[model samples]
Target: MDVNKTYKGVALQEVLTLLQQHENTSKVIAGGTDLIIQLRECKVTPQVLIDVSSLEEIKGIEIIENRVSIGAATTFTQLVNSPFLNNGLEGLKEAAKSVGSPQIRNIATVGGNICNASPAADIIPPLLVLDSELYISDINKSRTISLEKFLIDKGQVDLKTNELLCHIQFNNIKNNQGLGFSKLGLRKSLAIARISVAVWVEVEENTYKQVRIATGACSKLGVREREVEALLLGKPVEEKTMQLGAEALKTQLEKRLAGRKGMEYKREAIQGVFKEALTKATYLSKT
Candidate 1:
């Protein structure tokens, strides 16, 4: 609300130039759904805002060879309707649909969600299970980093003062691989997730060839549950295996959230959430 300047950015290079000029004083805004609220609350008072909502370079979803690229400016509405995100990637669609309301989804950008780095970010768990990567650019050069590494902490990331996140990239899901997501919130809509889980698995018959699990609102950041994933990988795809994985997750959460009051509830709730996601993932893998 009290910015020295605001630019309606039309080009990626131009946005980078503005960022370089303003340095740490500039904030990159795409879809201002979150930033505007932060501005109003005085949570952030940037001297300049570079709006990239209309930048063509960061506004669509495309496939280049075996990789899928999602522009940072792509809205949740776009993700919900993308033809390329069908079949095994239904988890992403579900996540996108769960974010805010219809109006909020229309303007909120996936890039904005990632950049905002909220602990309860609805879109992150699915992306994490897919092993997504980020493409970052600045005035001088460009670089790519894994989404896992890019996230440093709650409300923190590896981005530099002058860098812009251009797009997210990931390998195309295969017929044998599927991704699923489930979340528990206070209400069905417009409620931040208390617990969210995403499961990605590669299955052949009754065996799991590979497995990846990610959770949101269970820690400082949305993160992969490698220990639980390891417990499920190479194991039989059965109730016993799922139960074991769930127990492993609870044990890990017990340690991670030892002193928190939500620990007991989350440790128990994760079982059902993990089961629902894994059930959907298993069903998709066979289809």
Candidate 2:
């Protein structure tokens, strides 16, 4: 295919204008890590490329009134190094750090990762546990949708061709709550995750008051383990309770991925992933 035009150094407004003009023929590029690969493999052939990587509208992290808003273009390296993410949002930090290598982390934006909608994308599970919402904007209008809802299927998302993902926001966990993430990959470095879990827990005097669990790479789309979360809610935060919760998560995974290749291995691997995430979340809550 042939490229009709490439626009760089454009602001968000101009980018939207170009997208409106080109419609389906236009593609946005931010940190081009994934888009470049798709282009090279002939998976996508856009006549126009709008580079929004440096747009000031989507390049930083902000905290306001107990909520954190991350610009869609924020890189994994930026997330990993943010001081604000060091405390209550450690799960997100861990997930960002677990991405690829330093080079990929530096170049890959969170929006790109989410828009790619890869089941194995490390950032999605943690964001899901946080109940994150994405802000999508187009020339005509703007709207917000939950990250879970925004992700339609593997390699697909609920985004219009002319829309851009602007920001991701989630409430900050309170002192009584903690978030934790764990992933098992084939290799330690530069490896795609085989199984990953993110857990958020609220503890009240040794009992689990509220719980949210999300898993990645174990299903067609990264999803919250609502059954496991319900089973763990109001239960004591102890070894037995955690073990039971893990088992429930395994059952959910088995049901969702039945008869698929590698289902058996993923079902078994989820136990460890859930355990690690739960243990860390519990430990963090206590502190």
Candidate 3:
């Protein structure tokens, strides 16, 4: 909590060197929305802060081949306004828009959101449904891993002490595919999500050729509802099928949150959220 050393205007190489040298004692700061709060509460007290807010290596969005690559420091506002996201990635755009408020969106970076690893993070469910992959680097080396595999638990991730998340990339949805997102919160704006769901579907001849469903706030980490996805894959797209898939998700949540407080509410709430997400994706695919 006490003031110490701060490094700024440094390049990526310098940041990595400082991180490698200080290891656990040095913390990276960007946006500072979550880290500032943690520091204020004395949850983390690093002796050195390496500010990566302006690092060029992690600050833009690019389209390479069939994948959309987003820099780690790209803010939520940038995501919401990007024309590229309109091309079948509306779910991600909506998720970025749903975070806190205009001010928060302007400052909160996608990397910060992912690195925070909060179970209720709005962007995680959408990213999971996108089948996103994360790139991580350190002074010594770099690696890539699936977003799902990178998240280990609440407030924790697979990142090493000296590693930094560089960017995220996911393949674009094909012409026959669509994505959707739904969130349940106490209010329409500036409300933390109580339960949220995202759906991605690939349709062929009016049937579900592939289905992916991810949920947030209902588990220790945002996760894919594999049982629900399994139930819907290869099934005809219809109201009845969607209802059944929603029920499958409800059952899965029951098992995942057994004995926890608010379990019943989550089980019941997931039904509507899942249905909404599926309906949106189905509609978009047909259009």
Candidate 4:
């Protein structure tokens, strides 16, 4: 990771100014868990590195007017220990805990995870189900975009040359609403996900009133499974109904990954993953 210049950012405005000046040559780094590896591998070759690890404006998690806002630089360990993420939002903690080991969790930023846009990122599926939004800024302008739209494709996003992702925001879970996450990895906490699912649902009298499903490692990027969500919505939360929903997801996977090497296995694996995630969501809604 050779860089001609590095700046430790002290303020948001200062960082933006630096980014404007170095637009094409600078990369914003928080935890550097992903960026450093990219740099070493020559996947990215920014001549200047701007360190925003100390920028207070982008380094905490808080609830603002019923919306949960996480500073882009907040670490996975922070997410795991946040009291505000409890109640029906335990799925976020579960996802954060599944990211690598403790050492990696200690510094891996949620913003970094999203910015890297890894198809198998452990944290993305859960965030996708939350319908998260990103706040991005440059020297003179700032904008907000839905996470789904912000993600253009694998290892790519809608971010501009000088813009930085400042934070992520989502609605807080309410009564009868719950979110659940489940991942199938080659090795626990070490290997990337083979498949992962996250479900956010609102249940009423054992029926699914509203449901959103997101999957990782099943496509070019973590994506919402709207077809499966539609299949489960307005349906009774019975084992048989849920099984049918899983079958629907399997069918969707079959079409999406047809002719791919892992298509058959993923088509089968998604059923169990979807069922487990939906089960947790329904149980949380009842509690």
TM-score of 3: 0.97
Tell me the tens digit of each residue's lDDT in model 2 across 86-200. Answer: 4767888999999999999998999999999999999999999999999999998999999999989999999999999999999988888899999999999899999999999
Mind giving the per-residue lDDT tens digits that candidate 1 earns over 1-287? 47989999998888899999999788988889889999999999998999999999999899888899999999999999999876999888999999989999999999999989998999999999999999999999999999999999999999998999999999989998999999998898998999999999999987999899999999999999998888888899899998998899899889999999999999999989989999999888888
lDDT of 4 by residue, 1-287 (tens): 46899999999999999999999898989889889998889999999999998889998899998899999999999999988776799888999999988998998999999999999988889999999999999989899999999998999999988999999999999889999999999887677899999999999988999999999999999999998888888999898888988999999999999999999999999999988999998888888
Give stretches of model 2 more than 4 Å off. Answer: none
Backbone clashes, each candidate: 0, 0, 0, 0
Query: Which of the predicted structures, 3 or 4, would earn the higher lDDT when compared with the native?
Result: 4
Pull out the clashing pairs in model 1: none
Model 1, position 212, has a per-residue lDDT of 94
Residue-level lDDT for 29 in candidate 2: 92
> lDDT values of the candidates?
0.93, 0.91, 0.90, 0.92
lDDT of model 3 at position 283: 75
Write the residue-wise lDDT of candidate 3 on 20-103 in tens digits. Answer: 988978788888999999999999999888888899889878888899899998999999998776556778888899999999
Name the candidate that leads on lDDT: 1
Worst lDDT 10-window in candidate 3: 1-10
State how far residue 88 of model 2 sits from its true place (Å).
1.9
For each candidate in turn, the TM-score is 0.98, 0.98, 0.97, 0.98
